[model samples]
Target: MKKCTIIGKTNVGKTLFLINFAGYLGLKFLDISLCDDKKILKKYKLSINQAIYELVNDQTHKTRCLQSIIVDVPMGKGKKKLQLIDTVGLIDGIHSNIEIRKAISHTLTIVRVSDIILHIVDAASAGRDELPSSMGEVDYQLAQFAQLKRGYAILANKMDLPDAKEGLDKIKSEFSGNLIIPISALHKKGFKEVRTFVAHNI
Candidate 1:
């Protein structure tokens, strides 16, 4: 199956996007596969609400591993099942915590192999300075590296906030020529465009 990985700095709504995107795709229950550094996969099942409550958090690096779910994208008549993986949040400087560094390494490894890359950035934070979720050096490097892939796009998240417009404009100016989809992950806005992009690529 094709794999689509969601990556971004912490508190940028990567986890919320994962769960809500699945919910947008009509999935009532998520069958999640948590893959660690050793490549050992542990499975769990949860409803959309349950998944959000348990997994989504405001803390930095809350997601320590690869959390994956299989979702069916409608094709001509049948459907295409793709592996949508949520990754640990990445930071600019070297993370002091060893485990987080390892998780970041694992996320990078997954990025190298993924068929599609959905790079999420916080639009509201992008308008601000020095926030954890603000666009940084890592995001720039990621855009450069993922350029080799055909299915790379930037998701400007948190559009519901007042500051997001400025952030989105900044992202557009900085990341020109790249495909960008403005989305409010919390409210599920701009999901149709995202779904279309995924469908066309996958």
Candidate 2:
């Protein structure tokens, strides 16, 4: 199995990309939605019907930025499965979200144990001029990930949007490797290339 982590800040489509990959892998949306430690299930006392409506009928479950780390996510690559994890969005400041903080620690475990890291960035949002951050400075999350000495690839998402090409250029020129890739998860564009790269890189 290929151990990998899908990392990006909030609203960068990390979960959305993973969900699409799961769909590509043919993962069925079961009503077995459980909260952290199954607390929400017991606290809310959610019934199966409720779960179906809340998590099932809701297609945007994947759209969530940082709720939990979905494990063993399918990517439709046959029996040779890849370990896919959706991490939380990293805030620009030191004060990270609870989910993101958990992801950072959990991601360390995943990165150490994994073979590759799929780091996605919101190219459309960040732009090519300067990296975006919660503190309105150099993207701290990008800096953090760049420090990782591991097999990783960059996906500059939202390429369909205007001004994204410039950002894509910035990433390509800045990274200078077969690492950065232009993609739009929302449009399902560049998905084939992204999948193919992960298939080979991992």
Candidate 3:
């Protein structure tokens, strides 16, 4: 199966997007495979609400490992299996915590081998300063690197927020040539376009 990795800076809604997107794809229960920095694997079966409550957090770096789910996207009359991988959030500088540093390293390794790259940027924080989701050097670098791949798109998440429209406009101006889909992961808006992009590439 092809792997589609979701990556973004800390607290940028990567985990929420993963869970909610899976739910949108008709998964009522989540069978998530988690891999830690030490490469130990564990599995959990969670209800949609339970996964949101336990996994999604307002705090930064809530996900200290890689969490992935196997999803089937509709292709013509059939479905195609794809691995949707939610990675530990990236940061601008070296982390002080060794565990987080290791997790970040692991995330980068996954990126190198991923078949698709879904780079999420928090539109609510994009034009702001000193926010975890604010567009930074890391996002620019990721876009540059992932552009080499045939399956790469930017999801400007959190369009439900008040300031997110402005941020989305800023993002559009900044990332002029790339495929960007403005979406609200919380509300599942603009998901069809995302699915279409994924389907076309896959």
Comparing 1 and 2 on TM-score, the stronger one: 1
Which portions of model 3 miss their true places by more than 4 Å? Answer: 36-40
lDDT of 1 by residue, 1-202 (tens): 9999999999899999999999999999999999964575789899999999999988888899889999999877878999999999999999999988988999999999999999999999998754888999999999999978999999999999988999999999999999999999999999999998999899
Question: In order, what lDDT does every prediction score?
Answer: 0.93, 0.55, 0.90
lDDT of 2 by residue, 1-202 (tens): 6656666655566766665655554555522222232132322333323433443221222223223322343245554556565555554555434654554555445555556677777786666333441112323445355547456778888788777877777666666654677887666777777677666655
Global Cα lDDT for candidate 2: 0.55
RMSD (Å) of each candidate, 1 decimal: 1.0, 6.2, 1.3
Determine which window of 10 residues in candidate 3 has minimal summed lDDT: 35-44
Best by TM-score: 1
lDDT of 3 by residue, 132-160 (tens): 67998898989999989999999999999
TM-scores, each model vs. reference: 0.97, 0.66, 0.96
